[model samples]
Target: MQEFIPHRKCVGCMSIKPKKELLRIVRTDKGIFIDSKQKMPGRGAYICKDLECLKLAMKKKGLEKSLKVNISKDFYEKLEEFLKKLAVKSFDAEVWE
Candidate 1:
């Protein structure tokens, strides 16, 4: 039997993709966080790894709507920085399986 792969929708591009191919951001009681392990508890939303998608999410307020929280400008800046670092490291080696 074939394994069943999970799929999730990207809040930015509004495209459905394999869960592993996207990044997950979660909102918990404590605060919002980037769930790299995809195991964080709370309300979670998915987004494409591409920077363009991030921009789209910001422009459209996709993440905010999905998470039901008002995201701050500073948080977006931090998220952008994190994504930039992720982009750089991704090219070095295939970290995600």
Candidate 2:
């Protein structure tokens, strides 16, 4: 028997990938934040771990659409900083899993 792996679609690349392989950005009543634990309770949008994906998502306002809220520039800056810290360049399955 094999374990079931949940898959989610990236709003930027519009590609289906394993849930664990993508970064989850959630918007709650409190505000929007990166749900690294994926336990944040609210509307969530998934994106690839690549900076390009993040940029595309921002440009297309995909996160705003998914969360049905206006995303601030500060939030994007913070997210960019976080992604930089992670040094995410490409989709490395081994690193994520």
Candidate 3:
């Protein structure tokens, strides 16, 4: 038997990619936060690490619909900032490319 690799779809790009390649956003009773470890409980949505995908997801309200909750503007701003920081720390370069 072969090991299975999980796959997830990006809410922004609608592209299917390996789970490890995407970022997970989870909505829990407490609030919404990026699930860096993909271990949070509650509804989850995936998005590409690229900022463009984040913009598209926000514009399309995909996260809101997927999480079945109203997302505030401040949350979006915070998510963007978090992603930017993660990109910086992970790649040590701009993620736009």
**What C-alpha lDDT values do all the predictions have?**
0.87, 0.84, 0.84
Q: Which candidate's TM-score is highest?
A: 1
lDDT of 3 by residue, 3-43 (tens): 89999999898999999888888998999878877887989
RMSD to truth, every model: 3.3, 4.7, 4.6
- TM for every model, in the order presented, reads 0.89, 0.86, 0.86
Cα deviation of 47 in candidate 3 (Å)? 0.6
Candidate 3 backbone clash number: 0
For candidate 1, the per-residue lDDT at 27 reads 98
Where is model 1 more than 4 Å wrong at Cα? 90-97
The better candidate by TM-score, 1 or 3, is 1
Per-residue lDDT tens digits of candidate 1, residues 1-77?
A: 99999999999999999998998989999888888789879999999888899999999999999999999998788
| Model 3 CA lDDT for position 39 | 81
lDDT of 3: 0.84
The candidate that achieves the highest lDDT relative to the unseen native structure: 1
User: What 10-residue stretch in candidate 3 is worst by lDDT?
Assistant: 88-97
Task: Report lDDT (Cα) of residue 59, candidate 2.
Answer: 90
